[model samples]
Target: MGAAPSAGRRLGWKAGLSAGAALLIVGIAALARHRAGPPARCAPGMVALGPRCCGEGQRLDDAGRCAGAPSRCGAGLSAAPAGCVAPGATVRIAAGTLRLGPSDWEAQGVVEAREVFVPAFSLDAFEVTEQRYAACVAAGACAALPLRGEPGVPVTGVTLEESARYCAFAGGSLPSRNQLAFAAAGPSSRRYPWGDTGAVCRRVAFGLRAGPCGWGATGPELAGSRPDGAAVHADGRVFDLAGNVAEWAAPDRPGDGMSGTHGGSWTDEAASALRTWNRRLVPVSTRSPDLGFRCAYPP
Candidate 1:
């Protein structure tokens, strides 16, 4: 038989083994806890929300998982399938200067105002309507728009790529952020396209969840006369420059795969969102039910 260790030596060996075993157990427990956290529990294409999770471009479902589309679409744009069309021709805006940016009274943080010069260009008086886009689809020059909204409303739910295609089909192009601001705010650089009207529905085609399609009304009325009180562009060409539907702008920096959207939408109640200075930079692939665009032409 092997010789036994002395009692003192045996005690020391036993204690060392016990301490090592304790440390190993602690390490295993820590690893298990880490694997059980939210980052681990969530699946691919899902993000963990408070006590739940959501999918990309989707809100939290009742089951706490991301499912379905985003909750906010432009006001008046329904989940229904239909198209929209504006009834007016394009307007020509002469080359002019526009003072863009927030007013001194409204400036916060580092936001400042600047003057922008826009070349002579032609812009549509109204946002592109579903009917206009459909014509392009029929010609096989554009993709079919998703089934939502009405024919008389501003064409919502288009990506920047789609908007560019539509403009090209119409023999025009998308306006730059600076151009849009100039067309809306003019040289005075008013607080809003319609002055400081605050959050009034009359000044902007908003507040109604469903657009003016029902009850003998117009849908997203940009092509023609609105129910009075809507702001006209400072240059006196485009309509609903501050609200109605957000319009896509040409990318400020090309090759960056990024672009900007301007104006306020019907879903927004905040006056600031509808100002001439407001700009939302997003990916070109983005599509929203309340987002649409207008076309511009060089002089």
Candidate 2:
């Protein structure tokens, strides 16, 4: 009011107000940044996920906290909520030199009968029964077969690929020819699974003078049907190594379109065919009524 403000003075007053408003806005932005703070830091061995950190193989829980994932089992084990566990009973066989086949086999150029060093491994004490294979099929891991035996009887009519699939589902692989020989003969290199003694009806289930197992067995018998047929190993005994059903074994050469069957089936009429060293080769896709298999695992 004292001589009315000059034009320049009014303009200066407006500029001062604008500068003060800009400074206030800058201060508010700074305060917001300070409240928000820097990005979250994760501890070692952990990674930041959103607003939280999770460890390896871990994820966020419903409470927004880090949690562990379900762990997977290794070979020869079954998965559970707690962890992995053995699928079934297994007999541990000590590593030893396998004197494969008989002298006659080598002489006739049937097999080399080489002395191979076999690493220690574990094997199922019994042949895979129909029930077991059926479970695998139900789980969508194995293929179906024309199963004829009872649930306790050894599974048959399974192709090599089907057998392998079942073995994998059981957390194992097929036994090698050398491994089967060692399990039957051991270090002494016995001629038969029990001993050098000949296979009789009382000791094995084979085609007898009358019929298979001295009975009219047209197909496979129950697993462990003959208790005397068991073979002693360093850790325990395995049944049906000489008869009941011929077991699928890994081929002498892998990927050769050929596979091997060890032991002998009830259809065999000759004791020589039941010897531990005796092996029969067939196409990988072959499926026989007397063909079955067992599984082997790491010791």
Candidate 3:
């Protein structure tokens, strides 16, 4: 005759089975999480709460979900799955204060370093390309660029008025001097778009060593050809803010008949000329091969 198992033995067996099942469930959950990868990062001015991205003034509700309507995007910007966007391949910049001058260099018209409140706006990621401008011209909104090159390259030799007209046709406007400086230097007021680093062929398309791109290149390469020259912001990247081509900004004073050209062009050889704060005044009607422009949208 065989003896029956004790009650304690049966209980112990049941406990072991339950423990094993629990351990298996935990392991499966960990593996699933690992396979799912990290959670999505929220855009600038938005906070990530679990699976929801809440705006600046939003709050969590009792159910642990984000509550409140998302703040509206600035004028000319529309909310998209990838944050705010403006017409003409632009990136949105949240409204904030920035130091708007160069602390190192002092020039005649250079305003001393001062805190300036910049409103929410959007700026083109790259200078206007010939392809985009050609569309405007074809639609009868803009005149044909005088110095045309590759379709992918920036269109140049447009007067300040011409640039403004193109911007308007593209659903934006010529960025003001302060707006240009804000986008170039950001809130940190970096000496260059990529930081304090000196300008080089890899970082800019200036006429230094050999030429643009340091390979005896004659003129500006394709727009955004110099990726290292991008001005990285929390929102996104703005390319060629310190090179590629000088950009025309709206005159600081209306009726002055003079506009500021900034960001030193491919023909600029001096590193000092490429400084974010470096600018020169020219007659609004003047146009040069190295001068181009991008647009800005209002808040």
TM-score of each: 0.64, 0.67, 0.66
**Model 1 weakest 10-residue run by lDDT:** 75-84
lDDT for each candidate structure: 0.64, 0.72, 0.71
Model 3 TM:
0.66
Task: Please identify which of the two predictions, 1 or 2, would achieve the higher lDDT against the true structure.
Answer: 2
**Model 1, stretches more than 4 Å misplaced?**
1-85, 209-236
Give the lDDT of residue 241 in candidate 1. 81
lDDT of 1 by residue, 1-299 (tens): 98889999999999999999999999999999987642232233333343222233444334322235533222222221221124546767777787654464665553456676788888887788777788899999998877333455577879998999989999999998887887777667766766655545445654334432112122233333232333354355467787678899999777798898988775564667777778888888888866899999876
| Most accurate candidate by TM-score | 2
Expressed as tens digits, the lDDT of each residue in 78-190 for candidate 3 is 44432332345678887777775546554335656677799989999888877778889999988876543345557888898888999999888999888888898887778
Better of 1 and 3 by lDDT: 3
Q: 15 in model 2: Cα distance from truth in Å?
A: 99
User: What are the RMSDs of all candidates, in order?
Assistant: 17.5, 26.2, 15.0
Clash pairs for candidate 2: none
Q: Write the per-residue lDDT of candidate 2 for residues 170-233, one digit (tens) a residue.
A: 9899999889888988888887889887576656767732353443445655465455657898
